[model samples]
Target chain A: MVTGPRTLAQVSEGDLLAEIFPYFAAHDGLLIGPGDDAAVIATGGSVVATTDAMVRGRDWVDEWSTAADVATKAFTQNVADVAAMGAVPTSLLVTLVADPQTPVQWAVDFACTLGRLAQESSVAVAGGDLSSAPTGTLMVSVTALGDLGGRRPVLRSGAAPGDTVAVCGTLGRSAAGLALLQQDLGALAEVDGLRAECVAHHLRPVAPVEAGPAAAGAGATSMLDLSDGLLRDGDRIARASGVRIALDSELLRPDTDVLAQVVGGAEALECVLAGGEEHSLLATFAGALPDGWRPLGRVEVGEGVTLDGSPQAPRGWDHFAG
Target chain B: MVTGPRTLAQVSEGDLLAEIFPYFAAHDGLLIGPGDDAAVIATGGSVVATTDAMVRGRDWVDEWSTAADVATKAFTQNVADVAAMGAVPTSLLVTLVADPQTPVQWAVDFACTLGRLAQESSVAVAGGDLSSAPTGTLMVSVTALGDLGGRRPVLRSGAAPGDTVAVCGTLGRSAAGLALLQQDLGALAEVDGLRAECVAHHLRPVAPVEAGPAAAGAGATSMLDLSDGLLRDGDRIARASGVRIALDSELLRPDTDVLAQVVGGAEALECVLAGGEEHSLLATFAGALPDGWRPLGRVEVGEGVTLDGSPQAPRGWDHFAG
Candidate 1:
């Protein structure tokens, strides 16, 4: 018989599933939910799908991040990919591979946070898989499915010359927060509100999920999530669309100023331009911008991304690069 | 500039993507493919979704399975989940988390084999993610989406008393093969045809993927994939449907006989009853059985599964159970 605080090895798969299933509430879109071989969902004519994974030690360290924090980041990253395609995220399928010795509390915390966030966003936690991994390893993978709602998907290759580039969420807060944490200033959050907020942003990013469909509805020609930094992700649109994205340094001052308060002026500017995992919506529009969107720059007949008149090299997170 | 047979750490993410993207061919169902943040696919009124993952050391050993073998098993497992729901699998999203020092050829081999199989199956390779893992860890997760074609999903809880229980594919070959391999008879294939077939079955098990929807169309009341052995998975249907699955030992003789050629009679019987990873379709029908399906038992008003009027204990693979 299992006693108090039993590890996963001591618990049966059925028992663990019984514990995890209750966290996911049913929704109208889910025709068939968990407990089956596959989940059936009512989808639009076209469905948008993407998968992303986060591994412990590489994507996050247990010393600085909680299970809830990992869950939040994993959820945001995948949903943001669907949002980047100008679609409404409707359902998610999560997969967790963990060592048998992993604490039951960790899985419970992750599921509770993911379910709560998914429900709040009106996205159903349709189904998921659980498997045992090697010792000391824990990884989570999420596949987000979205509905296009009859709108044409906004691709990264749709930007054209003379289009106004805009952004809909915070830029450098996450990166600035990482900087603070690296300096062992996490304890400073109790004394400084701004520092705490930065740390929180870095740990749990909230993507402007609705802004994706909104930008499409407002005639945005091209869009993507600001995941791999502003400069690097922006350059993707520029190269794919065969145009140049020219950003005005003055236009980014507002975002840079917010980071400057914590990380100083030069470092803030760098963070705003080069920080990854922001999960913000970056898009280009030929017409008027959507509400809550701030203009950043414009598309020009050139190549790559530029700041003012100078071309900038693409630099951001690369999983394989040394 | 990266050259030669370099490790993943020696190549940039962009170079790796560029190398892998060409392997995936575009399909009409895939409106948006891998180049974008998310893939867009055409679906029926309802879509079936499921996710499954396999870890390196836990699920496979490098000496026993090649990268291509792993890819095939991963693809089959996810697609089998969709098939179990009586849906036509249409698209897949894959994710790989590996150490940076992993050989580039492993990734290339996996992608090439997966793309080839997906094309042959008429399933589109939609989109995927790649991330770095801790040292000595490798994992792959796949999310398969299927079209229901306007049919009601055949759920696990729909079987009633007097239903005919049947199976649509091979049963104990996979487990028999694993036994032969475990006994170091994998290299004895040249001397014995049956041993070779068993080895092949264990290495790459294939499911009758198209038979699922056909069974549903023929009035199957309940259906699921035989992934975790016959007795254990049969018990699941029995518990979920609140009926007893009574198997006739005489009806299972053919499958047992086939396995008996490689292994002894008693061992073959054990494999037929308790072997896992078969990926075959098991269902109960209230009407005429579909083609390629053979009768195995009957659903009776009771609890759990039985064989020859005797209660059988549920035993199969449990990822977390000690």
Candidate 2:
């Protein structure tokens, strides 16, 4: 159970970082990772890494997302990127900039939240920078480090035609939560489960940590995370692997149950297809399906993605695209 | 030579980061460090790392510091921290936030300057994140990675009473340059050599990159960079090593000519003894002095740092203390 203050809002980020980090002891292999001035990781084998940045007005909010929530969201999002490569997360290096008006306590609490999440994910915060910003924006950039663990990393470019396409983890809950937040819809507040789901999904996404290792163990050829929407991310894999992807709507029916009443069946399908930031593991398996596998699509001989063997209707999220 | 279209005042920060990062070419060791949605650095034995952030307005500015100047300052400052422990800098990950109203090209030029410096130092900007912030502020945070090269890292500890103290690189130039900046003294501008020192020392701090490995090779008992003034930093080494340090002012007489005009001999000595951010390497060695060692002081049996065998005045920069 999560313990500490009654609400995360009360604790500052720096204090939180100081609190949870000491609980997780360092390993011998972690020669330079975490605590002291910086954290170092053993990287003799192979290290897979990626970096992502989040800003205050553009990324999250104090009114809706707490410091802890923002920290959790950032940590998991980076974790998902490493997991997509069929690698286990090993370390995280963070950089933060605050304004003069920022409470040092809040900064500390945010760091603690980040540390706790990293500890839980078996990743170390390692090292980071702190400074004052001229503006009010709170900027956070996180570097995610992963170890290949002696296996060949599954890249975005190895999917072969006739391979099974599958995904693991929830989708569209974050978008739905955002929509609800945008609309200021509080009616769902009474239901603990629904409210918790909305908030948790948006604040702290749980990426399929085990799925990547399992897929690697099962001999997956190519993989990626559904960060930019299933259709869009699938297209990336397709293009990289030089294969076409065909999705079956029947298998996606499971998503309709939660989203149909809110946005209608068609829109629900579109969100499930094109809504981004789900952080679900989307991969192509070359051989027989594993026991727990629930397939939603298949790779074909063509060079693009299709819905039920036809061109899909919706486009995906493009940060620079208007 | 630096080349670009936009002036520092005319460009925004996000666009700047996007423009300048393309110049860097990633190596095989950097599996995921900078682009393609994330970054990674291979850990060959173990790794040493740290992160520090700087904010425009809070740290420096175009009105005073040039973009190239600020870029160099940021790099040298962080590199010094990693170098303090006898670690060799291998890569850097930078994250920046700027306003839309800010000049985009200025930031781009800044990135170019940063990239050039990274290349010069044999370090690459491996990965980073760019985001938008409010007006008038530029926030930059850097995470530095270093390779120990299998040598036992000479930490701040391990200094014994009989160890000899030595410094690699120049001292008091940065402090002199800072004085010139603060006083707006054009008088020093007439002195050709002094003017150069004022400009170069303030704009680009030259860190003792080779000194780390050299000290490690020479059987240094303890080592640290002279970032937080010689006297103050010596105190840190003293506290960490649980020994006293005595500085010989006679060895510093050669520096008086440079400072005789701006600040008297006493004040010049004070700056060299207590000024911060020079980035020179201050290290202690056991037994006989190494050839080419420029002796500045000696480690003694008691605690505290002494100037001419007396307790030195308390002078050092503290982030929290006013």
Candidate 3:
């Protein structure tokens, strides 16, 4: 009849945990890791904590993404928040809530990918929970904790007038990739160069993990992850700091020019201004721009965001608003 | 037609967050609270971390529980695990994934209850994530972080053959209450005293949060939270410590006898043996039993758990087994 426990329903939670525990290694300076009531890790006086979740249908579909891709996205989304706090991510606690009918292999693949990514980043998979869900439902969430080695947290309220607005990672890539997929599902197999890269970024975008602490060390006035769009996220900084963010089209050309070749001239500008999930670091500096960061705008004495002296509405991803 | 955001989809994520943010107070020694990418909290030299999640259909039914009930249960379940680790819970990161049609009042009620609980326990509500789920789906998860205060974590493997097994909280009340509700959904309002208490416990379980650090201070050799029934969790300690746990039926009468008044004798025994979600602290002590803890059994030179020299099968909640 049955050779092994194939579906999650066929195995006990302990059996599944036993199969997945080996993928995660202990965090640096961890007193305990997994397989216990809880895990323990050394924190440098204070810890930076954040969480993110991805649901099936809402976050991704099986057709465009794999388990590894899901793991990468969840990992980056969480670690990006930690980095945006100007902290070094030290550990993660992941939860997988899925239906009993899900294949056991999917959990294994997700764990393997997450563990490898943690190891590469030197972050620890400390602890997590697993629960069975209703039919046709599978979700994953991550809680990332980071260490701040005595640096003051760079808050969104610190952007003063005359500060330079900058970003350290790609812009509009994930949104453009989503557009490409909407245009053609087979864009990955057909398209090459920037288009393929965009699709890949949409599926599993990379975050400039190290640039966060670098910006903090370089005296960043304000910072945040570009999770929504430039205008929407910029408005957050503007509202918090009580200053306006004035963007120059000439400065965004480095990103828009490249995306134009893949999509179009007009669409590229829209993507660069209103696209989401880029996972890029957006910050403001009072002095010299730090390494790897390019200036895109400036902080002014007004409110909201402006593009070439015109007020633009903030347009991007908002979970419930959509 | 609507005065404010009635349903989640009626408002943006920011507007909803602005409504809920005031419910949480900044934690003691918290450098930064919500309204940022992450929250920063001061910790001891080390931090104890654990996560637990509850799904809508599988973990609860909306007909039987309210949003406040869900928050209380989730809080107790997670803090109980941290208490079991012999640490003081310092902060929590919560995530709520709900369908767009879910009412905003539900979220507000949950935050209110959770914030009150955190304030009572002196734990900070650090930060969290919110995402919209598909139709008819809702879930909540909590990640609790604790401070050890320089004490070594009491591991399950530390039990010796001569140690005394003990528990510091109520037993089988939640399961017995479930039985009452299953027998008659009207048992809660129709019944009073112990029966109503059982039903209330089943709806909102409370753990002996203080006894964990007390047990650790009193030199507990092994410890764990009794979420999944006594027999199954006892077997875990037996397997981990490589010693047999010989439970005393005479000692169990205090629990079974109390539950038998609510349920029948046999059902009470079964409930005491295999009830899940009790949120009690179970431990092994080499010296004298700590205050608030009563002896349940003794560790013996064998494997598995036994009741009065008779082996008992490990039976309890296994998330995917059903």
List ranges where model 2 is wrong by over 4 Å: A1-24, A32-38, A135-137, A190-192, A242-246, A262-267, A289-294, A300-305, A308-322, B1-21, B31-34, B186-191, B263-267, B288-293, B312-314, B320-322
Error of 2 at B204 (Å): 1.9
Please give, for residues B3-105, the per-residue lDDT of candidate 1 as tens digits. Answer: 5677889888888888888878888899999989999999887789999999998888897899899989999998999998999999999898989889989
> Clashes in model 3: which pairs?
none
- Sort the predicted structures by TM-score, highest score first: 1, 3, 2
TM-score of each: 0.98, 0.85, 0.98
| Alpha-carbon RMSD to native, per candidate | 1.5, 5.3, 1.6
lDDT of 2 by residue, A1-322 (tens): 8454333233444444555456444654566544333455776555666667777876787788777877877887888888877788887877766654555555657777887777776676666655445536577777777777877777788899889998887767766666667777634645756645755676667788778877887998888888778888888788788898888888777775676655567777777888777888888888876555578789999877898878774367653221
Which ranges of candidate 3 are over 4 A from the true structure?
A1-5, A185-190, B1-5, B185-190
What are the DockQ scores of the candidates, in order? Answer: 0.88, 0.39, 0.85
What's model 2's lDDT at B249? Answer: 80
Per residue, candidate 3 scores C-alpha lDDT tens digits across A157-228 of: 999999999999999988889988888744563547788889989999889999999899999999999999
Per-residue accuracy of model 3 over B1-322 as CA lDDT, tens digit each: 6565589988789888988888788777678988889989888888899999999999888988899999999999999999998999989999999998899999999999999998899988999999999998999999999988889998788899999999998889999888877788534545468888888888899999999999999999999999999999999899989999999999889999998878889999888889999999989999999889999999999999999899999999999986
Write out the backbone clash pairs for model 1.
Answer: none
Model 3 lDDT, residue A33, Cα: 88
- What is the DockQ (computed on Cα atoms) for candidate 1? 0.88
Evaluated on chain B only, candidate 2 has a TM-score of 0.90
